[model samples]
Target: MSISVPQLHAELPTGCSVDRSGFMRRVSGVQAVSPISPPRSPVPLRLSVPGRLLAGGIGLGCLVILMIAGLVVPDSRGVGTHEQLGMPACGFLSRTGIPCGTCGMTTSFSLLVRGDLPAAFRAQPFGAVAGVAAGMTVWAAGYIAITGRPVHRLFRRCSATWLVGILLGAWLISWGWKIFVVVGGLVGG
Candidate 1:
């Protein structure tokens, strides 16, 4: 396979210089955005079974931890199940008198695991979405672990900016809903 790069004249613009490969030339005047450079595969061209299993195992382990936390903790009206585990309250919430973006995520996950969809949505819509994703990841990772194959190439092809945008959008939307509910409740009561 060959990649074609556009050619420029020998006497290029003032700040343009050719790279070692003589394919890409960088111009000083131009700015490039390199937010998410695609990671070069460390694994050889031929996929290794152990590498696939290792990746799958790591993903499965994270999902298991999340599911266990959900199972053990009881979902409550507010956030800070972490406090129940002897952690401090959310400093942001304490100072601002408002919940932060991740305030109710644990409770939402717990409600989701307990099959309480409405409460999960009320707590944080993103949590329900994340819970669903965690479940799917566990299933997919389990399959890859058993079959010794990976399906990560598709994810690798996706743009990092697009994925980040989707996540931030979800969080913003969930935060807006939480604010609206809190304000509405204050007004009603």
Candidate 2:
């Protein structure tokens, strides 16, 4: 039996598939037919046209967020930067005399825009992490959109549940850190 040339798919023209006994060998830039081969490193995932469109949209969204951050001035007080956008003060802090979990996030984003990483982290750990995440997403999306390649191992190894759990854990930890900093007088305002 002989291997056939590529066949178009509803998803991608180069979409991968494996037959029983796994005779297919996907090579760099193209798939090929070969004898049974030893195990190799994971192959990068090829993006479908829709996937590329989504990636472009995601990159654009992240860039828009960063641009908005650049427009805002980081508050020296470490919080209340959202007020500059005509938002009211934190009602939780005002009524309960305690900073909310997300307090200082806006200021952190503003500091990130100014390239003051230390100040951004100081303002809000979550916000700093979020800024970095957004930046990375923009980079990854651009790469995927341009090259039609995505880090396959990452997506293959992690499930949706696992990703959600990690995000939840990080959020909780950041919120706790914020509360500690404010209560310990380490944070100003």
Candidate 3:
């Protein structure tokens, strides 16, 4: 059955009504009725040559800053020692005995800085992975800012099942590692 827009509006839940022109209108309330149109497909903005260049420069600068911070930072082994410096390890991992996934990240980064990839991997495999991910993220963000196109769109299109599976897998791996460490300590002692 074909129903008029106004008729559909009138049939809305209580306290909601429609205007004479068949648009949603609030008769008496603090909330104002604003008619919203369906979102249109975004058209690419025509940026000036200088504007594009400026964006590219800014992106490159951000990438440089990220790399400097990630690779040039000195390592220390004290709880809350480098808290003010935004170093990830000094906050929680040092205080707690449990080794976080990124626990030896600073040492890993330091090893990387000293051109010891093997040592970095030995220090913390997860940290090495994180460092690579962070580098890629910075590069992708910079590239997007300059080119106006996203480098990694896979995350945007990920399905719920894929996310669930990833989370479950990570949890299982972490739990298994913890169990192995505990069992190894018991056997050795």
Say which candidate scores most in lDDT: 2
**Per-residue CA lDDT of candidate 2, range 131-173, in tens?**
9989999998998899999755568878999999988898788
Cα lDDT of model 1 by residue, 103-149, tens digit: 77777777778888777788778877887788778877776676666
List clashing residue pairs in candidate 1.
Answer: none
lDDT of each: 0.70, 0.80, 0.52
Global CA lDDT computed for model 3 = 0.52
Clash count for each candidate, listed in order shown? 0, 0, 0
Better of 1 and 2 by TM-score: 2
State the local distance difference test value for candidate 1. 0.70
Model 3 Cα displacement at 91 (Å)?
Answer: 7.3
TM-score, every prediction = 0.65, 0.69, 0.44
Q: Residue 139 in model 3: shift from native, Å?
A: 1.9
Q: Candidate 2: how large is its RMSD? A: 11.4
lDDT of 3 by residue, 1-189 (tens): 222454554356444566666666445665644669988769644455676566567657656644554555434331122333564543443455555544455555555556666655555554445556556665665665667664435587988899789756754564344334433443210
